[model samples]
Target: MTLALLPRYDEPRLLTAQMELIDQSFGIAMLGCSLAAMILASGLAITGGHPGALPWAATMVVACAIAHFGRLAVPDRLTEARSGRYARAMTAMLVLIGSLWGLVAWLYLDIRSPAVVICVLSLIAGMSAAALAVFSACLPVAVGFFVPAIVPVWIVFLATGDIAYLPMFLGTPLYLVVLMIFARNYARVARHAIALRFENLELISQLRDQTARAGQAQRQAEEANRAKSVFLASASHDLRQPLHALGLFVVSLSRTTLDAHQRQLLTHIEASSGAAREMLNTLLDFSKLEAGVVTPRPRPFRLQPLLHKLENEFAPQANARGLVYRTRDTTATLFGDPSLVELILRNLIANAIRYTRAGGVLVACRPRRFHVSVEVWDTGIGIPTAQHRDIFREFHQLGNPERDQRKGLGLGLAIVEGLARTMQTRVTLASTPDRGSVFRLRLPLAWTAPEEAADPQIAMRLDGLRVLVIDDDAAIREAMAGLLAIWNCPCRTAENEDEALALLDDFPPDLILADYRLRGHRTGHEAIAAIRSRVGRRLPAIIITGDTAADRLRNAHADGTALLHKPVVPGELHAAISTLMRESEWSRAEQ
Candidate 1:
């Protein structure tokens, strides 16, 4: 680094470094001179004479220190005017010290002794050398000292006009030139060093500032994400109530007689309602995944059946999109959570169908030593290798920048990743751009075991089933009444826990379907608890909630009752009811 490369703000700093060198030089030069004077005085005293160099050395020390000490007394944070004045003062003091040293040449000028001549010459040479060493950090200071010290000695040699002395005069100017060059180079080196130090310090400061700002930005982004999640959870719960009621009403409408045109209109309305419900469900799934609520219940399951189920679900969707769907079935039984495995497969196969436009989608199985790798391969728009990690992030989609909801909400892969982690496994991907993509899920293969007789479960008939519905929302209570009316089940609707318990006096409910939250913050579990106490039986109950809270869902699962999120599909509600009924029947039969 050069002085020019340094900012103008550091001019004072450069000046201060040069001045520090001068400070050290002052003490050293004075010490050297005092020692020389003592030696000279002792030599002359032995010869019965007095030394003249002593007084001259004393005077020079005083003169030089005047300006140097004045600079020290000045205030810190030197301004431009003050620094300039100090430089001029130092240069003048340097000249005074040089002239005094030069005058030594005249002290022994006319002496005939050869020893005196040699001593004078040696002393002047030492002074010139000292000047060069001490003040070279600033060339002007060096020049001021050396020029006055050496010129008088050069004149002494020339005045003698001896043939032998000619070289001294001729060589003096060359000596001075060499010293100037060395001093200038030394000054540049000093300035460059100071500049480099300041630059490094500035860079370190900037790096710290940038690091702090980046940390703050990351914190802010995380806060925003958390706030957005809270808002969505609140909104999801509020919206689900009406949609749940609408879904029930729609289910009842389906049981009525209708012509072709009316049926088509009804189907479109159902599709629109289904789309809204699907998005909400996706959000609910993501919430549960984040809340660590999904616990995989592992068991021995047939891999081929899960594959067959996936094929049935996505094959029609693929066919509708003008693409082929195929599954290379494997008879190998796998041991894992059957439902969670099915959910993961559904996400992967759905993604395969959504992205593939031309060729087809394939589900295949490869047997490893300990794990069976179920792969979903597709001739879809392939993901780049760089984006393989990002594709699993929530709301991060590939080739869908416009965020087409029909393609998906971008939570499918994120849910898959979360579920896979909860199951203590991982998902891997291999893809080529525009060629195809393959997503593989590795699961533990079940070892061969003696087959136990399976207990068959038959669907429970809903005819004449006594059901009780408890909800604070009137529309929900009315919807429940209408739905059960179509089912031809004798049903009673209650507004509170008291009403539900009161209904059990005469018309006891065989099944209780209760909203999760009622008036005064009462839960479905509370109302169902009252009903069971009144009936003196652990009657089957299903808790239907619009809450996207995973903690509540997990807690609800602990009591071993059926749970369903709202905007519930007709088929899901019906299945849950039938399963709970069959379980109640089995429990009674065992007792």
Candidate 2:
């Protein structure tokens, strides 16, 4: 039992907690003891005929009150130094109170009446019990009070040499021993409780620290992801600018008369340029998807026309490969983003055509009660069962171990899956090795009116039209001017907005074609806006951007002006210019 108390003495925190618990109840203990003393002293003076006892008891009560109230002077925050001082002061107060009780027990034992002496003994025993309950949190303080109060009475009983008081001398010590054991046990329980409380507090603090660190790590990961997206967008734009120029140069060169060998070499250059453009487009799509910028706008549309369009687009490639191409059309109305659905089907058909050497590819739509499933089937070198799920992963290819650019960049199925997810759908694949493969996209069915007839495809003539090209890249500016010249169009080129505006003042070009990113933190949109504002008329303009950044695309779209991506195909560029010119003419007529 003594060893158990020794552990608490060595632990400063446990000792401090015990002292705090003792301090908390000190006032109540003092109040109860002072009141009890006053009653006992009054009863003794009345019954035992001792008038001096009342005054001495009154003094003891006053002293106890003063001592308990003195604890209020201690600070609320109990540091180690303050707690030690408080504990010592409390122990001294207990000793003083015990001495007063002992003095009363010694001085009053001479009462002749047996009833008065027994009442006095009862008062001493009662006070000891109260002290045990109050100061049990500190065993030494409880012992200080208990021993003095009870032991003095036993000594007084022995001094009387009375036979009847002999039992009290033996019983008093026995009572003291039991009370001391109770105080020791209570102190042990209190120390255990305080230790557990502090341990819990420490654990809670550690958990909070871990939570803060985890939050910081999560924020860092998000920042790194954002940085990667920015780097990819910047790199893609820079690479596309040169490729755009090369494609334009190749188109311009093709128009010139050349020998048979040179023409064949030019054809190879065109194919290579086309492949590079496809790869850049794939990267751009991937970056946009990773940045979470693509949004699906679902609308109801006829599936037959969409199938016919895909058939026309892929028929040329199929014929060139000597493979049969077929489509089973339906008048089924589907709900989804039409452009995204078209992109998914196009990739599936392209993949089919690229892989199949001898057999044909089929495009069909299967109508369900609530939705439609558009499937592309082909008798190509099929994917193995194990690699079925892996085929949709980016840069994952089947049977193309050499990574031949001619076969494709292995991003076709990956793009298909991404676009399907954006539309809240999924693309599923089924294939058997050496037999064939089928890719299906499921879309909800919707009720919609039949679409109008298709618009005519007219060739846009650029002959004799005045065009202004703005780009920070000198090579791009030169290549663009040369390409426009080949179309017999007079063109002016500028490197910045100020130069372009300067050119606008003298030449007053019919169309403005500006790159999205420009010198001095300017953009093609800004250049076009400035030019339109300066001329005091809505200009027919096009924003040609090599950037595939989501914010750039969104801004360009919000401008509501014509846009063409860089490494621009000459035919597409011509059509964009023609459309803007026609729209501008119509607006002028309305005015």
Candidate 3:
């Protein structure tokens, strides 16, 4: 049984029982004392003591206890009151008779014998009877009657003494002592019962509150999950519609030799594709992070090259939006997963551009005491105080939801937050609505020297680059091959392991880019492994896949290859290709 429902003492019920026990004990004791007093008075009578009143006092003692007992037994209040009044009347009669008996004993009987003892006993008995007159034994009213009755008896005891008076003197005090002990025990038990009841009541109240909190938490978690599901469904349909349209348009345009205007239109279509792809990737990445799928791959990289690339790529976008985008010149380097840092800044800058209508976006890096702080500040429709924390929650959008809402999937800040956590960097936000916003990333500083700077004259190009592309999707293969061809890469497309192996046999490519999933339950890893075994060379390859699922990243890692999740950016594609080509040549030369 639970502690709360444990069988324990009840206060009121126990108190009633205590009072009953007290009355019963007192009644029995009173009857025995009354008989003893009667016997003593009879002995005095046999000695020819003038004691007509002695018999009367003795009769009163027995009568009072019997009446009080009857009154206690009669549960009815009116009957109890009548019994009480009758007992009080008997007490008054005994008091008068006792006084007369004591007087006659002193006058006619021997003062030195047991006659004085009987007189004293009769006096106390008479007053005790009167004690019952003013109060009920179970109520506080009894003290007034009890005190008045005992006062006269105490005075008489001081005045007279005899052999029979010893029992009366000693016994009354002894009985009071016993009653005191019983009263204390009864009160202690009563207090304990009361305390237990109070504690139980408090526990019950606390349990109610805890239960309410738990239910609320459960409901909140469920609601958040439902919201994520709905957002995913809505985003998939909305985003894919534009992507499919853009792809069809791009394919149709590619069929003809286009003029300058047509080529510019194609470029705009590609730009639109990039924007849609970025938003879709943001949503997918947020879901991956929420599901604990993303992990960091730490490596050394020249920060300036990444910064320069960002400046080159976003400069046009910022100019188009009438926003200034700039970065700080700092020698302070950072040691972390470069990809995560890039993701963090990309989201911050994109969000800054999205919100800001007219003013500038600045990416600044400065050296602190032991760390570097990369700050992205924008003068825009800034975040509200209430929405600062909320914006980082998945699918949470601020301001008018319908106003320029198509620019993003509301997962940029959430992705930034996740990437920051993974990189062990601190990200902070400060903003004022319709004024500006600033996001800061605090990272540990690294050592760098002037001689360590990257080669300034190094060209960023993929011209004459040989790339082997493996994927199960024919349309994706065709589109990527076409895009690669635009960059002047000698790209070969393959359906699966057999096709990729056959291509590798004919011509060993400079780099390999394969989709994670392939036909016939084969992975890119198997194809890459088969090629590596045949050629006796570690081919630099990238596992590109639309599966943002956690197991895919782990599986890619197990294959010992660099990974890039789809849909891939043209810039990222070029960068990955260039990096692998440089690294592959270096390793080959070392061998």
- How many pairs collide in each candidate, listed in order? 0, 1, 0
The CA lDDT at 397 in model 1 is 92
Looking at model 2, the pairs that clash are 244-567
TM-score for predicted model 2 compared with the true structure: 0.81
Give the Cα-based TM-score of candidate 1 against the true structure: 0.78
| TM-score order of candidates, top first | 2, 1, 3
Instruction: Write out the backbone clash pairs for model 3.
Output: none
CA lDDT of each prediction against the hidden true structure: 0.80, 0.83, 0.65
Whose TM-score is greatest here?
2
Candidate 1, residue 586: lDDT: 84
Q: What is the Cα root-mean-square deviation between model 1 and the actual structure? A: 5.5
Residue 329 displacement (Å), model 3: 4.6
Reference-based lDDT, residue 172, model 2: 82
What TM-score would every model get versus the actual structure?
0.78, 0.81, 0.57
TM-score of structure candidate 3: 0.57
Q: Is candidate 1 or candidate 3 better by TM-score?
A: 1
RMSD values for the candidates in order, in angstroms, are: 5.5, 4.8, 11.8
What tens digits encode model 3's per-residue C-alpha lDDT throughout 269-372?
88778777776677667756766657787655556666777778787889998888887666556777777888888888888887788878888887789877
